[model samples]
Target chain A: MGKMELVDSDGAKLSSALNRIARDIDAVFDVLLPVPDDTRAPLVEAMRYSAMDGGKRVRPLLVVATAEMLGVSRDPALRVGCAVEAIHVYSLIHDDLPCMDDDELRRGKATLHKAYDEATAVLAGDSLHALAFEILTDDETTPDPFTQAELVRTLAAASGMAGMAGGQMMDMAAESADYDLHTITRLQQLKTGALLAASVEMGAILAKIPREGRSHLRAYARDIGLAFQIADDLLDAEGDEEKAGKALRKDDEQGKQTFVTLMGVEGARNQARALVDHAVGHLGQYGEDAAVLRALARYIVERDR
Target chain B: MGKMELVDSDGAKLSSALNRIARDIDAVFDVLLPVPDDTRAPLVEAMRYSAMDGGKRVRPLLVVATAEMLGVSRDPALRVGCAVEAIHVYSLIHDDLPCMDDDELRRGKATLHKAYDEATAVLAGDSLHALAFEILTDDETTPDPFTQAELVRTLAAASGMAGMAGGQMMDMAAESADYDLHTITRLQQLKTGALLAASVEMGAILAKIPREGRSHLRAYARDIGLAFQIADDLLDAEGDEEKAGKALRKDDEQGKQTFVTLMGVEGARNQARALVDHAVGHLGQYGEDAAVLRALARYIVERDR
Candidate 1:
């Protein structure tokens, strides 16, 4: 269920797929990112730092995986994958800015604006967010005008106030010492889970899946999103800063209300386990083809970092 | 044909429309803007300052005018109109920050980041950008999904690096002491013209106009956009800072290339007139239906502020 087990079994294929996608992503990033020639240095550096800092590409991979599950070729999903990563990168870029988390560490290095200047980081984030939609709407691979519209709406909704921004608002609100559990979970769901849900839901929609399946996928994403946040809190509780590539337990100083804050550490772990089980149950519809997804849910909870 | 004549004739109607739409737009803004309570005060205030500024909703007016031209109801375009305004306000908020323009005034009031702090302004801009699309995708008026998708792509392209950001980049790059007319024109197109173009073109799309008509509208918008920028530059050249609510002759001091910098004031006036004439010419196919657009173009070049 852990990264070790998944790595041992499907390590080569996933690695090769990830490597290929990363190259494609980097190439596409080169073209799609708007680095005006004169001011390109800071933007290029910021974009590379945020985008290439290296995550599992889980969202983009979900795009490909979801497409695969729907019996569609992965090519069309490539742009969606790129778009999803762009959103993720943009969120990370803004989240790390001095106005927000004011963090120095992200992906094992200085957060954007810290590595670059504040203005450059801000522009980079803004440009990247715009670029994500631009990538989604490219006339080349995007389905029809209608589907493109849906994609736009879906991603926008997820990234905006009702989704990530809403969560961020809640998170900011919950910064006080007495935030309740419901309020904290609400923040995490909207802030972190919304885009993750959109990442999967976007892939499903692109594959033209039926409504029933789409709903199921949304449910699965919701469960895992909460589970992922809980896992994040758990990691912060015990994770090494070097391995986690960011300051650990920093949320405590910030008085951030997290799952572990709301529920005791053991209770938070139990909740995460329950969410994972719920997510896996939803995957029952996909059968053995859901193996990657199954492994992903496990990885979400069990990863040390 | 120009401002004084149109103002004398349709002043009542325009004022009433403006008043009604303004109220409607205000209500929408109040309802849709971030309400982050005490915890999220920073994000909320930032969004409000950027979005709720009491500016004339010219872009939203365009949406209404174009929709009326096509004999469609304005209800569907209402939310989209607000969405466009959100993007516009967000862009201005971000653009007026110290790193961008260091401006203190917009619509005769302090700019968002200036009124609040830089961080809130940044977050407000970011969230508002996302909010624009969120409004488009929400099932408010139930525009066809295809139409919504096209709107998404259109707005994204208009707002991204190739549009607003690209223009901002050119503006930033033009901080040097020398530049030519063409570069100046290009910069103006990206900076001021791009969103203006989106304003008109997006209105056209929302009305579900034919492709040929859409192209013509874009051409008309392109001309008007240039005219708008030229007129603004001319105003700055001769404008009173108190009336303009922004500095005058600053472009000259910055050594930035502008139409006024390239051509003498008289020449810029001639260019603005020509562009407006060209904008009017493109509406020949629309006949009497384009009267409001023609009026708008005239107003752009002739308004005192």
Candidate 2:
């Protein structure tokens, strides 16, 4: 009740909205996945374990907030929201595998591979990938099949070879060979930024926003996406954010080239702030409805996590 | 020219048709995942390596053959065929991962993970999975958005937790625990049968054949899917086919209770024959149009590789 009163400011409103979006999207996940007692019990368990009760739900928040701002209902937005989160969650699950990052902890708990075995984790990540497309195409997600098809295309483009997965391959390559700032930036843009931007774009797609009508929104997403990564690099460099903690903390120890390493920590933080400002400027055409997105842009730079 | 004239009977006709479908489907795959010499070159290379120059292309054959039988054009059918083959290739890539079956050989060549590293293999498989969904929803696959959505949904359902991936989870669990005939049947049904059925069902979907119209066709798929596995088990039992190899051979070595092990070799062979007969019986409703499917069922039982 007290938190509800604090939601009047743009900053607090975005926070409250994010929390609400997380819960709503999570409900959608629960309904789709349920509790696995079937032959896929371990897989269902693994999927539920990775997707539920986890993370900041930033991708879902962007989808819901953007769609709601564009006059789309929470239901369809949440469906796409959950779908994008599935892609994000799966990347995390796979990225944490032993052959990859070998992470033990994620979102303050053991990573899925640690919680389950490597095989279950891999399969769960994969099933989640399939489930994302499944939800986008399901009737509940969109009564219009055309809209559903677009959602599938958008999610796939963001997750595929030229997007998230390709970015990951580059990331692994960087582990063996030193990368310059341009290469690292390009890598993170594909790795982290593409999916984030896709979440907003999917929201726009659900509302049938045309390509010409989406330039400003696309710009806003691009700015915020990069800003989010820069802030993340700063946090990982700091290595003191109690909650922003996980596998990335060891990147510096591993001599990996991150944004903070390429640009000094202060410079990286400033770049994030500057990008956040640009991100907010890109939303100037929208009215009061754009307040949540504006606050989210600022939050990208300001949040500890 | 002589080969074309030789396609008079069911066996020769189906064999020639299968070869044609494989070539057409491979061409489609070449277009979608074109060879890359860029930064994502290795990932693209890995993808092309596994998906191209490959196995029997049975799934794509089913799609094309069924679609042609129904008088559907070749382009869309081939697109769907390529999508289905993407699923099959991705499954093989992941199955050969060190954490899973860890097979070093596939199609009598070194597996993707063996040729490249394990991480590239994982990303390549993941990207291929995304590409499958991408192709299903692509405009070239079908101009009708509703049809595209149906394709996406069908592929997802056949590949996700309740489908192929879930079946794989059960398979992994079976390694540590004993499963009876019913459990193994259900497992393989989900694992192998679901996708095979989906390939046929996708053809029907492309031709706008409603669910009720597809009953006998589905029955044929079920019978042949089971028979295919039984024949595979029999092959493994005999340990004679050098190329029809990998995972099942290890299962036999480990004393896994396959169909041949449980039913006895002669009994399993009889069951496979009965299943092929039943599969052909299910095709009686169609005229000469169902000849390829009927021949394919028999081929499932009798093929050496």
Name the best candidate (by lDDT): 2
lDDT of 2 by residue, B104-212 (tens): 8887688999999898888999999999988988888888898888888999999999899998988887766678899889988999999999999899889988889
Where is the poorest 10-residue window by lDDT in model 2 chain B? Answer: B239-248
> Could you tell me the lDDT of residue A72 within candidate 2?
97
DockQ of 2: 0.81
Clashes of 2: 0
Model 1 clash pairs are A149-B149, A173-B39
lDDT of 2 by residue, A251-283 (tens): 777778888888998899889989988988888
RMSD of 1: 3.2
The segments of candidate 2 whose C-alpha lies over 4 angstroms from its true place after superposition are: A1-8, B1-8, B245-248
**What's the DockQ for every one of the candidates?**
0.56, 0.81
Taking all chains together, each candidate's TM-score versus the true structure is 0.91, 0.95
iRMS per model in Å: 2.2, 0.9
